[model samples]
Target: MNLYLLRHTQPDVAPGICYGQTDLGLAASFDAELQRIRAGLAEVHVDHVHSSPLQRCQRLAAALAAGKVHQDPRLMELDFGEWELQLWETIPRGLVEVWTEDYVQHAPPGGESFFDLQQRAISFFDEVSANNEDLLVVTHAGVIRALLAHALNMQLLDAFRLRVDYGSLSQLELQDGRVTVSAVNRRF
Candidate 1:
C-alpha cells in the first residue's frame, strides 16, 4: 500500500494564531496552491482519498478528488481546545512552557495531548492498511507528523522536529508488514 499525505493548503487565519481544529477556510490563493499540488501529484495515481473534516483540508481534497473524498475526524488537526484561534504569543507563557517541556504527555487546558493525536493517527493507519490501494490523505501537519512517527518508529519529540509545510506531500510505502518512508515534506 502506498500512502500520500498532503498537508492542507494555507489557511485563512491570522499570522500568529493557533487555528488547529478550528475549522478555518483556505487562504485567498487556494487555487494556485491547488494547481501546484495537482502538478506535484500528477504522476501518482490514487485509488482512495480521505480528508479531515475541517474545511481547509476538505476544500483541497474535494478539489483534488472531484467530490470523491471521505471526511474523517481522525484526520483532523490537533485539538488545541482553548488555544484554538488564540494568538500564539498571547497564550499564558507558563502554560506554554509546561507544554513545550514535554508536549507528548501534556495537554492544554481542555485540549488533547500529542499521545491522543498519535492514537488517532494509528487508528487511521490500521484501518487503511487493511486495504490494498493507493491513498491520498488530505490532513493537518500534526496528523502528518503523527503518521511519520508511526511509520518511522521515531519518538514523538523527534517527530515534532520535522517540518511539515502547508501543501507539502509525504509518502510512505507499506509492504509485507513493513513500512518505509519515501518523503518527508516535499513541497511543489
Candidate 2:
C-alpha cells in the first residue's frame, strides 16, 4: 500500500496564532498552489482520494479530486479547543511550560493530547490500508505529523521535530505491517 499525504495549502490566518481544527480559508495563492499540486500529481495516480472535512483541506481536495472525494473527520488537525485563534505568546506562559514538558500527554485547556491525535491517525491509516491501494489524503499539518509518526514509528514528541510545510506531500509505503518513508515534504 502506498500513501500520499498532502498538507493543505497555506491557510488564511494570522501568523503565530494557534488555529488547530479551526476551518480556515486558503491564502490568496490558491491558483498558484493548485498549479503546484497539479504538477506534483501529474505523474501519479491513486486508487482513491480522501480529505479532511475542514474547508482548508476540502477546498484543495475538491479541486484535485475533480468532484469525487472522500471527506473524513478523522483526518482533521489536532483539536486545540480553547486555544484556537489565541496567539501562542498570549497563552499563559506557565501552562505552555507544562504542556511543553510533556506535550504528548498534555492537552490544552479544552483540547486533546498528541497521543490522541496519533491514535486517530493510526485508525484512519488502518482503514485506508484495508484496500492495499494507493491513496491520497489532503489534510492538515498536524494530521500529517501524526501519520508520519506512525509510519516512522517515532514518539509523539519526536514527531514534533519533523517539519511539514503547507502544500507538501510525503509518501509512505506499507507492506507486511511495516512502513517505510519514501519521501518527505516533496513540493512542486
Candidate 3:
C-alpha cells in the first residue's frame, strides 16, 4: 500500500481562531492552491481517495478524486469542543496552559484530546493500509501528524515536531507488512 496524504489549503478563517471539526470553508486562495496540489500529484497514481468530512478537505478531495471521495469521520481534525471558533487568546489561559502542558491526554472542555485524535486516525489508517493499493487521503494537519508519528514509531510528543503545512503532501509506502515513510511535508 502506498499512501499519499494531502493537507487542505489554508482555511477561510481568521488567524488565531481554534477550529476542529468546525466545517470551515476554503480560503480565497483555494483554487490556486488546488492547482498547485494537482500539479504536484499529477505523476502519482491514486487508486482510492479518502478524506475528512470537513468542507475544507472535501473540496480538495472532490477535485482530486474525480468526484468519488470517501468521507470518513475518523479522519476529521481534533474536536476543539468549547474552544471551537473561539480565538486562542480568548480561551481561558489556565485551560490553555493545561492543554499545552499535556495535550496528549488533555481534552478541551467538551472535546477529545490529541491522544484521542491519534487513536481514530491510526485506526482508519490501519484499516485502509493493509492492501496493495495506492491511497490518497485528504485530511488535516493533526491527522497527518498522527499518521506520520505512527509510521515512524515516534513518540506522540514528538509528533508535533513534524511540520505539516497547508496544501502539503506526504507519502508512506507499505510493503511486505512493513511501512516506510517516503516523504513528509512536500509543499508545492
**Best model number under lDDT:** 3
Error at 111, model 3, angstroms: 0.4
What is the lDDT, from 0 to 100, of the residue 182 in candidate 3? 95
Error of 2 at 143 (Å): 1.3
**Could you give candidate 3's per-residue lDDT for residues 104-176 as a string of tens digits?**
9999999999999999998998899766789999999999999999999999988999999999999999989
Tens digits of lDDT, candidate 2, 68-137: 8999999999898898999999999998899889878998899988889888988999988988999899
lDDT scores in order: 0.91, 0.89, 0.93
lDDT of 1 at 15: 94
Backbone clashes in model 2, listed as residue pairs = none
* Window of ten residues with lowest summed lDDT in model 1: 59-68
Question: What C-alpha root-mean-square deviation, in Å, does candidate 3 show against the real structure?
Answer: 0.8
What are the runs in model 3 whose C-alpha is more than 4 Å off? Answer: none
187, model 3: CA deviation in Å? 0.7
Q: Order the numbered candidates by lDDT, best leading.
A: 3, 1, 2
Ranking by TM-score: 3, 1, 2
Instruction: Give the TM-score (vs. native) of candidate 3.
Output: 0.98
Worst 10 residues of 2 by lDDT: 59-68
